[model samples]
Target: MDPSRTLVLNTIIKEKAVFTLFQPIYDLAKRQILGFEALSRGMSGSLLESPDKLFAIASKQERLSELEIICREAAIKQFVSLNLPGKLFLNVSPKALLDPSHPKGETRHLTEVYGLDPKRVVIEVTEQDKVDDANLLLTTITHYRELGFQIAIDDLGAGYSGLRKWSELCPDYVKVDRYFIDHCDQSVVKREFLKSIIELAKATSTQVIAEGIERMEELKLIEQLGIVNAQGFLLAKPTRKPPTELALLKSLHSEVRSSVNQFEQSMAIGWLAKEANAIHECTQCIDAHRLFEQDRKLTSLAVVNDAREPVGLLHRDQLTEVFAAPYGHALFDKKSVIKLMDKQPLVVDEQQELDTVSKQITDHEFDIRRHIIITRDGRYLGLAPLRDILKHITEEKIRHAQHANPLTMLPGNVAINEAIEQRLRSHHDFSLAYIDLNHFKQFNDLYGYASGDSVIKLLAEVTVDVCAQSSSFVGHIGGDDFMVVFDNNDAEVLCHEIITQFELKSKAFFTPEHVSAGGYWATNREGQKQFVPLLTLSIGLVRPDLQHCINSHQVAALATDAKKEAKRYRNSYLFVCNRRKPTVSTVRLENAG
Candidate 1:
């Protein structure tokens, strides 16, 4: 150990010169700041300016606990003074925590002094040093928990015996190290590790927070992996005065708002709920049997509590069989209906999407005979028969099929129009892209209709693959024309990706000579020989003005005008019409040979 560095550390601790910077952690699903992780730094430009050096010096001097306490105090003081929203995560080294000289109840005392809630402060046990006495460390953690502070295991995968510590501690939150999170989107091994962590978290009823997400791809991948909490520089960086609101959070909300199932919004489970008789849980089995016998149409009866909340579901066939068995009536007749009813019946909220409920039923392998108990605010509302749900889903599917394009099997003009109108009615901000193929007719004339069809399919495939990432809806408007309704402002990114992927993939359709020449001889609409360029996409993107656009027709007109503007360019082009302003921006992407 450097004696000079140790002297600097002692002076820093004695002077309480530690500074704290907070980096925000977000709930990706909610698009809101969940909390901030406090990072401590030493005095700037000093020999021990870096936290690593400062702490290393303190550890060698056996003053780590003292430094940690001062750091925590600084972090808590600033966190409360700034009036930051959500929990404050303070890093507490396990070695410091287990130190015999470590102060007890110091964090709770600080919270009390600052008038902050203990529950809102999280003690992040950093795994920087090995703990020789796990029992003692656990005891210290238990003391913090007893004080109402939450516990988190920091840098989980980077630590020794991380899994053992996780199993022993059963921390409320586990922060995966940045090493595993970095470039996770491209690494299958890292992805599998994340998946296993997620599965274990679910099993243990713990929340996983992915750390060090510096790229948008990492954020998207983590969200897709079912991680809700994330912290990274991409979202926001650590600052003494952390921002309460994040501008980047708007994109997360947009993705969520746009991804709402249009079909679910149009047709909710409430529409299928049929009024059915519900019996009290205390009702006798014989009485339920009699009611079923009297009402032949009643396939199942909902068992409710005194509060009218559904407790269980009694299937009529199950009840009838119980009574039909020899001496079965005598044994079960006097018992409460709750005894025979399914204790864990499938219950759904009335406002839930039929498709979502259908998935729940199918995924759980629920018996079709049991009625799906529908509730409004936890009270019994009505019952929906599985057959009714299936029939409605089937009818909707048929309607969708009828309006789908024959070639691409994508939603046709009618469905596209309906989607636009639905978004307008809901007063949602969205962008619509009108896509058309350039020189499609000439290409068809030269290569025959089969190759042209393949090209169209290629565009459809590319559009779907790109837009699907943002939960955007793609529709085949007709012949080489298509449309996409984007819920977020990343339409430009999606458009670029679609064009890039199509350019790369579409090359397979052309002969090497034609690809090299970049043109083919074909007869034009004028019935004269002309040089036709290779296939290129023309996209016109327009953000609809929800206030001015009264219907899909108006939106269509705006998009159509934009499409004409895009077609003016010779290469694959995108014309973005900002309805909020009069300005229009055009991007010309060169066609890939």
Candidate 2:
């Protein structure tokens, strides 16, 4: 053993060395601050050094048990000096705990001294090395648990016997070690293994914390896997710095909220679309051996339906007893899918509440879970596990209120712009129609504006009804004007129909007195009686050929011409078409010109 390691442990035993540090563990579900992990370093030559290096050397030299007791005491002393809101996570060694003679009085004193609840003090048992006596370690852990101190299994994914340790220890928390977390950003194998650990931890009523989160990408990945609680540098690091402006940290989090809200809205639309059979579905049938091969650990196979809808869910845990059954081997070669044999598949309809699905899985209590199929009419559509839906829901909800449209509820300018840009890139044959309502303001003035709003809503209804063709879309661009999109084949016909229905309905908004008076009304803008004719609709329809790579702004501008022409006459319909063949007479006229 190195002379320095010997010196540090000896002084630590005498309570001479002192070094303090903190690492933050987050509440993944609440997306809020949970607590700070209190760490210690031994002091030497009046210089600060990580206790980590010294702790490792002592453990190898048979002095590990002594060093652990002193370090726990020093951490306890420093922790009493400050006041914080969350639990204090303290590190411990499995070997030290197994000794059965180590002093636990100091840890209990910490709870009493700080007036903290014993449950708030989490004792982290890092399996940095394997244990020879598993039963003894479990016995020691149960004692601490009975005292209301939570037990955590640390460095969970690093050790070779991680699975065995998990089964035997059955701790309150399990942290996927840094080794796995380091490559989590890149390695599918590591992520899959971590996911398996999380699933296992959950099965035995243990909460899993994904540690060593160094990047945002990794944070997102783990979050999607249903690992809601985490600890890492990306969260917060320990330092001698005084209690920071920790509360101000919330202001900088606006972006996260906005992002979550937007995600929720998008998820909402997706759920709605799935409910309507506007999305397709697919199923996953990979087995346990396939689990190792693919490096993923999902509980159920996902199945998507013919309507592009997600329908049924298959949970892996449900197969836990069944997969090992006498006939379980057939599932591997069945190829037809396990759902074929499932008497009652776990499923939820698309139109149902997302929470209902969440209550089914991503749920804390590990019920035998599998695919959450999106279904209707007793048929399979698509499958997505509970985790995917939750990650998509929580993160997407951060920015729901921002950039959303108040009217048609499609998406205001932001989403509309994105859709237009996407359409432009795809270069599919589509028509852009600019729909306008004529004589709207005068009707509002005469009907006291409340009735005018009714007119606007009526026009909106007709526009939606007229363009309700399967592939068609309609949007309200604030006040009397709306927009519609469709395939080139029906673009003109849709516009004409919208115009006819719109004009006829516009008359309903007026009073019989106004009808008798030949469409004249007085308005607040100008008290004089203004003669307004019946409403009309003008449509500007543009296909991809109209402007090969027309941008959204250009589409907006070009669609206006057709609208102006449609509104040019008392009641008219105009189609701004890019593919209309010139008439022979017009061709002859052009030749003469």
Candidate 3:
């Protein structure tokens, strides 16, 4: 290190010139801010402005412990002054934490002085240097936990002993490195890595926070992978004073509500939500206890903030356990319910789908007896009993099974019609593609009924696979016909991919000689010997006019007409009936080989 830089560092540390910026970490399911990760930096426009440089210089100067303490103090002081509503995640380097000269109980003392609850502070153990003493680290972490501070492993996958440290620490949160989250939507390997981490987190009862998610696709994939908490520039950037309310979060909630609106009432979790009273987070434990005592049927109560947003959950049993203890009433009755409530209770949006919510509950390993908190736009709505949700999901599954095609297990005509009608009822602009196999009867005649069934199943798989990336609904229309209802505008692109994939996969069903010939001799429907083209898919897409389309029947008729138009092509084809307006009937055709 330069002597001049060392002098500057000494002055910086002596004056405690470090400052902190907070980036909000969001709970995607609850659509609320869970906490803020405190990022410390040096004086702006200085050589040590970057945290990396500041920390590297500190380490080189052998004053890492002192510098870390200074940074922590700055973060905690600002966090309290700003009156941030969520947990404050302070970065604690393992090296500093393990330093022999590092002052013990300093963090607890800081929180006490600032009148901040130690429980609201999460010591994020950063992976900057290798840890040589595992037992010492565990003991130090235990000391923090005893002081009511939560533990989190930062940059989890970027460290030398990430898994080892995680096992040893069993931290409350593990922040997955940005490398695994970057472009995770496009990388199967990264997705698998995230899946493994999520599964491990679930098994261990540890929450995983995906860090550095800068893209919308990354955020979507993280949510799809069942990660509830996330931190990244995509959500919010680090600032001196972070906004409590996020417009992006509200927009995301609106999108979720809109998606759920597309489904029928029976399919959404909102219908299962029962009216339940909520207690303010500031309500005393004694008052909450009395409320529970009055209602024998009430098992739990949602704890909400002044804005009616759910902050936690208070269980009757938990309160009962506390009061049942010796002098428990004297010890805790006057304390706020927030002190006794489950801060990480399973809270879900009311607009979430039943199946999606079910998966979330199961993935989180939530007990069925502990009711889930339901919210609409982050505001308290009601409680949904897990038993009722399971029962509804089971019933829906059975109903769906009955309405599913026996051949491919895809949704059958009843479900298909319902889907179309539901879309039309909601006035959602969607495209319905009627798909048919060209020369299927002749191919079946030559290959036999078993081969014909196989071909139909193949088409179902292809269509479903191609549309899997989107919110499209693929249904089996029976025999050689299939249907895909595209909720997104990429129907044409998906159609082309389906045609290409089916053509490639279907070649396995034909003999090499017949495949090379590209045609087979079969008796025609008129009982005349004729050459029939190899099996090919004919897709007819029709965008139903929201204003003109009255029902699924009309949409089906239009799709069928378009399919007839597509059959005019001798090869695999997609024929689109562009219903841009009620008065216009434009046709577009594309052949796929």
lDDT of each: 0.83, 0.61, 0.86
Residue range 1-593, candidate 1, lDDT tens digits: 67788778878998998899999999764456889999999977788878888888888789999999999999999999999998999999987888888988988999999889999999999865689899988888999999999999999889788888889888989999999999999999998899889778866767899999999999988866668689999999999999887788776554443454553354577788899879999999999999998988888999998878787889988998888899998999999987788765667656666666676666446677667888875589999888889788889889989999899999987888888888889998889898998998778877789999999999999999898787578999788888899987799999888888888888788789989998788876677988777888888899988887777767777777788889999989999986532224322111111
Which runs of model 3 end up more than 4 angstroms from their true locations? Answer: 1-24, 32-57, 65-88, 94-122, 127-208, 212-227, 232-261, 321-328, 423-431, 447-451, 465-472, 486-497, 504-517, 521-529, 543-551, 576-593
lDDT of 2: 0.61
Q: Give each model a TM-score.
A: 0.67, 0.48, 0.74
Clashes of 3: 0
Top model number, TM-score: 3
The parts of candidate 1 lying over 4 Å away from their true place are 259-264, 267-402, 406-409, 420-451, 461-473, 483-518, 522-530, 536-593
For residue 581, model 2's alpha carbon misses the true position, in angstroms, by 36
Q: Which has the higher TM-score value, candidate number 1 or candidate number 2?
A: 1
- Report the lDDT of model 3 for residue 273: 90
